[model samples]
Target: MKMIKTSMLTSVIFSFLWVSGGTALAEEPNLEAESAILVDAETGKIIYDDEIDVILPPASMTKIMTEYLVNEAVKSGKIAWDDEVKISDTVRELSLETNLSNVPLRQDETYTVKELYEAMAIYSANGATIALAEHVAGSEGEFVKLMNEKAKEIGMENYKFVNSTGLNNKSMDGQHPKGTKADEENMMSARATATLAYHLLKEYPETLETTSIRAKTFKEGTEDYIDMQNWNWMLPGSVFAYEGVDGLKTGYTDMAGNAFTGTAERDGMRFISVVMRTDSREARFKETAKLLDYGFDTFTYEKVIEKGESVKGKKALPVSKGKEDAVTVAAGHTLSVLVEKDQKEKMTPVVTLNKKYFNEDGELIAPLKKGQAVGLITIENDKDDEYLQEEMRENVKVPLVIQEDVEKAGWFSLSLRSIGGFFGEMWSGAASFVKELF
Candidate 1:
């Protein structure tokens, strides 16, 4: 299969971006905020934000990252869900001293790794979280290292972790010998939270299945026989509760107020919203629902190209040493352009084929491969010409190739054909020469 030249491929892709528009959404006015952000989960576009870089304590919301690490390790076979873990003396005492969230583990009691994870994810159990951290990395401090590494990998620039649970006190350093102030246990900005949330949703789906549930009972053997409920109070689907909302976590502390990371999907589009330091749980719920509503109402998903659809305006490829005369190529994936409601009518996609397609004689040429991109399908705004020099945007390429192998005739047959072809060329050349002389 012949590879398409780089210049040709480059020309094709750049031409596709110009096809759309709207009154660009107004940028946010400069202002201080505790932290807030909205992002398109699929495209990773920041829709709105404030104070994204200002790191603040994430409270229990810190558990989101903890759960993410656990899920990834399990999925990668670094750890098994059913692997049993023995609780350390430190973990047992802390669970008693603090009225923190937990599944009520006894000293030295063992439970499968999966059970501990379920408690942490579903109940936001701080004790369960620390236990899992210890089990995975042999110490909470090391697990914090892995957490920071993961944060960097996910593009979180202004984040850090001091402990497995997010409840670290700014004064207490986790490394201090007992009774020390927890030193800013976990620090994250609204932007980082949204970024991490988006990555988790796109990369691992099983997490949502557990987070979305309202309640789950601990398996029969793990210490306390109590069933724990999710702390995310907005789940009931009330007035401010968004429709189609599912699979997320909630956080709150006296210092952080109500912090929530939420997700909702509708009409094939998904959005992630984070609100921090809201006045009350009710207010946090109300604002999250409103943000999701604004996103859905203002935009819609537009399918720009259907899979296997023929590229418009692209030239068909001339064949080389193939059975078929020429091959037709089309878009590999359904290319969709998302835009505001009113801009749909103004968009138009134009397809262009290569001009230097066939050889001098109108016969198929050699060595074509199917699925090779011969030309691109472009999209352009009809109105863009009014303001811009080039009114074209290319979207996707249509490929052309040999439909079937075109073998050269056998030696004897080719010899006969060559004589005829030679005679034809001679006669044509002589005619041209005579005309020129006259």
Candidate 2:
């Protein structure tokens, strides 16, 4: 959908020239992580995959899902930024724990949804997260169901959300979300984590505006003000800051170790990266930098196929019964992909008419409408790289559409054509018999 933003056929695609082939590639980064992956945020193209499918505790990184649901609630008018959320005993008690990330939420105190969400997203505050979850779902445990439901709806595989806060149930003080075990924790594979981030950024890009905040005071100027610093060190002016690095979640626990879901955009290309079970706090961001560096240094986005570009051999398709015998077609829109800086020529377009538009005998039926998509031109490459999420494969494809309307043939014309076709078949059969006899 990134390339589809343009008017389907009006604008011209400028030549994006890059050096193709013959240069040595930067040595692929060797990561000290249990699982890691790097993908183009726009296309979900997997640039680097190291144990990507391995399931691991996601730590506070679980908040991404919470953030997504909050956005959904706000957008659906189920909740509002200005809505007051009264702190509960659970929230008050959790905020008192000195070990967990938190902002003070006093009993009987009510804060706006906007304030709690900023605390949850910016500071990874567990207490504020639970308050927002309860505000949206009536309870944090009920909110866990929403998280898993969303994960499945969005194509995440084998993901488990036992709590809304990405904290261990044991850490929940006997108040873990219902239907979850006391010892359980939130779990997701590297691929699933990146996929969640992808949908979060794509569906609700505004989440970044909060995540990108380096420092802010919660309820400033009041006794309630708590100076909050974003846990993501990769943002601007922070230690280990990486340019173009924006808002994303970070996580840590004894079982999950140091993990980060980091995203950065450079020169119009953005990448989402995940590193799980890295050694320490510093290592997570450093490892994420390696991934971000690899993506920024390695690939450049390219629109390999222009809108209305003719597929090399597929100019038109035979119609089963139409005023015209065939319908002319071309690529309905542009085809874009993340190509290695030196390997632009490797992308290939594979064209096939959609079977849904064809009859049982594989004939396209008419009347066919002009500008209606009839086929797909999929991008293939010599590398055969797989996407981080299998569903993202659809991103590398564009529709092949008819060039003009085709009216159905009149019955009289169809009858005449049918008579001619019968004679033509007879003649061809006789010729074949003659050739066999000879």
Would you estimate the TM-scores of all the predictions? 0.72, 0.88
In the range 45-128, model 2's lDDT, one tens digit per residue, is: 888999998999999999999999999999999999999998988889998787999989887566999999999999999999
- State residue 163's C-alpha deviation in candidate 1, in Å: 1.8
Alpha-carbon deviation at 175 in model 1, angstroms: 6.1
By TM-score, the best candidate is 2
Worst 10 residues of 1 by lDDT: 386-395
Mind giving the per-residue lDDT tens digits that candidate 1 earns over 207-235? 87777777778867544666878766555
Q: How far off is model 1, as Cα RMSD?
A: 11.7
State the displacement of the C-alpha of residue 115, model 2, in Å, after optimal TM-score superposition.
0.8
Clash pairs, candidate 2, are 141-177
For candidate 2, the TM-score is 0.88
